[model samples]
Target: MSHGSSPSHLRGLAEVAAASVLWGTGGLAVQLIREHEAMSPVTISAWRMAIAAVVLLVALLAVRRAGELVELARSRPRQLLVVGAGTAAYQGFYFVSVTQVGVAVSTVVSLGLAPVLLTVAEAVRDRRPPAAGRLVVLVAALAGLLMVSVAGHASSTGPAPVAGVLLAIASGTTYALTTAAGGSISKESSPLVLTSGMTLVGAVVLLPCTALVDGPHVTTDAAALAWLAYLGVLTMALAYVLLYSGLRVVAPSTAVTASLVEPVTAAVVAAVVLGESLGPVAVVGILLVLGAVAGLGRPAAAAGPVLPDPDPVRPPTAP
Candidate 1:
């Protein structure tokens, strides 16, 4: 409040922006290895959370937290459990949905609709409404999502597979909660503490599901394993840290819009890794999504964060 925003705050915002871009690639990576491995979503998710957790735990011990793991461990076990259980459910549903549909479909549905969903979630919890900028961002993002839906439909058009579409929508709904709930956890705690505890919870819940449903045999392929590791280490574990740290300075809508990077990265990766074809229309759709996200980032007054209404039946959460 003194001489504009501090340099440190500005720097932190940038870091969060960068983290979001990296996160945007997650779906594409999932698509690449989805069929390559026979493991269930639970297995993939378990490995991801487990590997990321280990890396994060070590990082916190050696550098960030500096030997505070035990202290954190003792302090917030229940909250950790709650976060992990929520994460497990979220990932399991995500895996099933992505498997049922396609990567693009799932991501567009979940993320596009996330703003509106999260707005309501926050409103209910805080008993207050969203800011105008946040609402605008939601509308613009939803419009972009609608474009994505049309593109997906045009790609197929054989009755459109209603179930998969529905699943994709459900994925988006979970994402809304994922973000709102996830972000709320660390206001009074360290990001590493929050991430580690929540992820541990996820692993505990998912490990069993992986065992019961996915069974003993897991993917042995080194490439699949490597990708899963990357998801855990870079996307889930490290990414969250960067994103959270950045959010301390960056506005939430701006941070999320910057995350459009994940999809762009994922799309390019999908093209190269899975050999999945894309047409001009898909490219245009990607451009539109990126453009919209970019537009939302101008400035608070220029075209900042777009939010949503407080009412429960505000609108359909997907495009």
Candidate 2:
């Protein structure tokens, strides 16, 4: 069978989609945590990475996989540094952008821009333009994302719109670079090991920034602690594990496009959990995003096969 249609590729797509859904829940978790104890977004993000790194480390030690991490650190320190620092930078820029430009502008610009940039990068690397159908799908997804974001925050402009937009662009560019770097690294390392190492690096990179920006506030409330734990374990650790694993077999462009599921999942979660109503335009936007994702799922005949899974015989370890 063609690689694109192989079971491994489909599974990779599913993994990426699952990761995006988990990421969607992160905002809700943050909101709940803040309800119990006020905390700045940077502090919360720092805690999320730190906690996830710790949890992943404990799991690795328990499973006797710590040696793998050690080996990865010794062998691929540069890739780890790029991915880890890029991860923290993207999130930090995003939060600051949200404060300056508002959630809607930040969300639309940052998230929407990544896939486009990645797609263009892919095309440039391959010395060809994207397929017409793929371009159509990308446009639909971006338009849907814009609609959903604007509908959610129509009047939510921030203090400095231009600065926020620039920061958002930086955030998206950082995300694209990180994903591309991570995709390359995943081909040579176990996703679990990569996630643990990079997240630890990310925590280190973000901690001091968090302290400087938000004073590293710690939450003592039980409810907030639990929510923070959820953010760390599920959203940060597990979701990233899935992402890196999927990147091993999925094209970076396709993977980023699939991850547009994040906003759609967020919209649905808000409606059901937060009693937030999705207006008509937002609902249509959701459909468009879902449709675009579905369209992108089809095997691309023109694009070359994805990288073969390095350990296709080995089953995925539990995150």
Candidate 3:
């Protein structure tokens, strides 16, 4: 890694961490929405994506960036669409995992698996093994993620843990692909443009599934609407913009590792808001996860972007 890229790498890590923190609050919001409105996971995801896309589009038009969206659509339509599909798959699988195994395990399985998958994929593509120190940090981060998540699993009796785990694995795979692809896509377009184009694609893919799963279920309650707005604006819109911006310079493995902060934030929120216990183990796990993230984001860990540049309209064909 070149020293010239160090600042960019650190910036990327910070952006990703900020996004993760926002995402940490998402589970609670989703739960609130479910309580207020009887909607399936798919339906909630649909609403989240669709509303977010609309919000981004409106903001773009308001700021005179609609032309950027149009240009990106024309220039990189296929890659953006692929990224959108991956985003939809990630959310769909994650929410389903949440319904089946509870939020803790779902979050653990999905987020935990992403860095490892990215590490392996990168190694394979680069034909070089990860550095010893980086590998150690990665393992430590994964362990801490598992510890925190398991400790947070106070309500393990949700549905089917096994099925949820599988779904969460799928979610992780999709998430990894999305993040890696985002890195490549960022090279071709700005984060705002990418977010606008990709979210539209995700909304298109998820709308039909939402309709089939929830069957015209709609709610206009103030609380439900509030939760939906939060999900759309914060979780979907802001978070994704941060994610893509980070990917512009962050290695996929480092980005994913830093994002383990999500579970830590989620745990603390659960303790304070949901009145769940953090326990000594969970607290220790939080420290470990944070430490690993810090290590991964340090100047020493700086590396070039994990993927090569290519046509934005191409299939997101490689890492």
The Cα RMSD of model 1 versus the native structure comes to 7.8
Q: Any runs in candidate 3 off by more than 4 Å, and if so which? A: 2-5, 158-162, 214-216, 302-319
* Number of the top lDDT candidate: 2
lDDT, residue 95, candidate 1:
58
lDDT of 3 at 33: 87
Per-residue lDDT of model 3, residues 92-118, tens digit only: 898888878887788778998899898
- Estimated TM-score for each candidate: 0.74, 0.94, 0.90
Weakest 10 consecutive residues of candidate 3 by summed lDDT:
302-311
Each model's backbone clash number: 16, 0, 0
Tens-digit lDDT track of model 2 for 62-152: 9999988887777778888999999999999999999999999999999988988988888888798987777888999899999998997
Which lDDT tens digits does candidate 1 get at residues 1-319?
A: 1323345445555565567666656666555567577665567778788887788777777776643445545665555565667667755665566656665566666666655555565556667675565566556556555555445444432234466667667766655555555544444456776677667667677676765774434677788877888889888898777765555444444555555555655555667766766566657766765665654443442122222212322221211
Clashes of 2: 0
lDDT, each prediction: 0.59, 0.86, 0.81
lDDT of 2: 0.86
